[model samples]
Target: MSSAPVIGVAVLLVKGETVLLGRRRSSVGHNTYALPGGHLEFGESFEECAVREVKEETGLDIKDIEFVTVTNDVFTEAAKPLHLVAVFMRAHLADPDQLPQNMEPEKCYGWDWYNWKNLPQPLFRPLETMLKNGFSPFSTELN
Candidate 1:
């Protein structure tokens, strides 16, 4: 395996007190709740990747994309050790009336809004690492 860590961009699609998340069916974090995001592509900015991934995965357009934080996630305990640099971003729906659809059913079960204070169990590692480090997506200042 390549020694370099992969860069992942995860968007915290905020709506009031809730954020958009879906049950992942991917190899990295199977059966875990994850934000709308994916691997960053060549020459792609973080904001661009967030928007593109959200649209491609959930069929929703996002705006106000801002960098929140980054996590160095090293999954050393996995059957195949993996390392990822997860860049977290905060954004909102471009249209409030728009709803998220399961655009890639093969990758996610479906999208849903969940209260940040009471998120679903078994969060994806990067997200779980963020929460454990006291990162909150709601406030004007990083929490």
Candidate 2:
């Protein structure tokens, strides 16, 4: 019998017209740009997972974490099939003055702020799913 898919939480840290992203250097999405996130630990709430992952991967604290959407992410691993339930979320820096740094050099290149309209190419599968679905959490048109 196949096991259930694992849960991964992605947090989009918003700052004005930009959001934080990192270039993945590890397996699953190597060389692709993606939001800071990781597998959800057992008993961890989505918001808590978001906060923890953001800090773990970016050396940044994020607040205002909110659920946005979910994606059924399917990919390959070691020539085997893999599946994951990706939970998307939006958040803001808990300390606005704190800048993001590359906390895990093994997993990511570094963190950088990019405008929503001009995001870095080759997004992770879950993030690309959000884009193809027309989901925009950080719209600049907040009037």
Candidate 3:
């Protein structure tokens, strides 16, 4: 039996021309950095998923949610074939004073802000797809 692609909601929390990202330590995309996001739960809207995932992973409140872009990611290196439909969205921290914390240290190293032009190495595949397609949170341009 074939399974459908998993839908994930990735949040682009931009402030001061930088965005929030975390180094993942899980089975998928281990040691690679990606935006703070997670699998979209049932009965949740895109914006709702974005807010929940950020809060779950970074303990940060986000606002000004807006649609960005979607990337179809496919990975077959793992035991089971994995595919993801990543929904990218732009948002800002509701409280500027709140810093991103590694709410789940077991799953992530920590969170930090990085310039769009100077992202950390070994980015997650979905994020790479975003960049390859010219998706920049700093600018409203996406190709």
Arrange candidates by TM-score, highest first: which order?
Answer: 1, 3, 2
Q: List the candidates ranked by lDDT, beginning with the highest.
A: 1, 3, 2
**lDDT of every model, 2 decimals:** 0.93, 0.87, 0.91
lDDT of 3 by residue, 20-133 (tens): 989999888999999999999999999999999999999999999998899998888866768989999999989899988889999999999998889999999999999999
TM-score versus the correct structure, for each prediction: 0.95, 0.91, 0.95
lDDT of 1: 0.93
- lDDT per residue, candidate 1, 7-33, as tens digits? 999999999999999999877788999
Cα lDDT tens digits, model 2, 14-97, are 999899999999768889999999999989999989988898888898888888889997786624566879998899988889
Off by over 4 Å in 3: 141-143
Best by lDDT: 1
Model 1 alpha-carbon miss at residue 22, Å:
0.4
Stretches of candidate 1 above 4 Å error?
none
- Which scores higher on lDDT, 1 or 2? 1
Per-residue lDDT value at 26 in model 3: 86
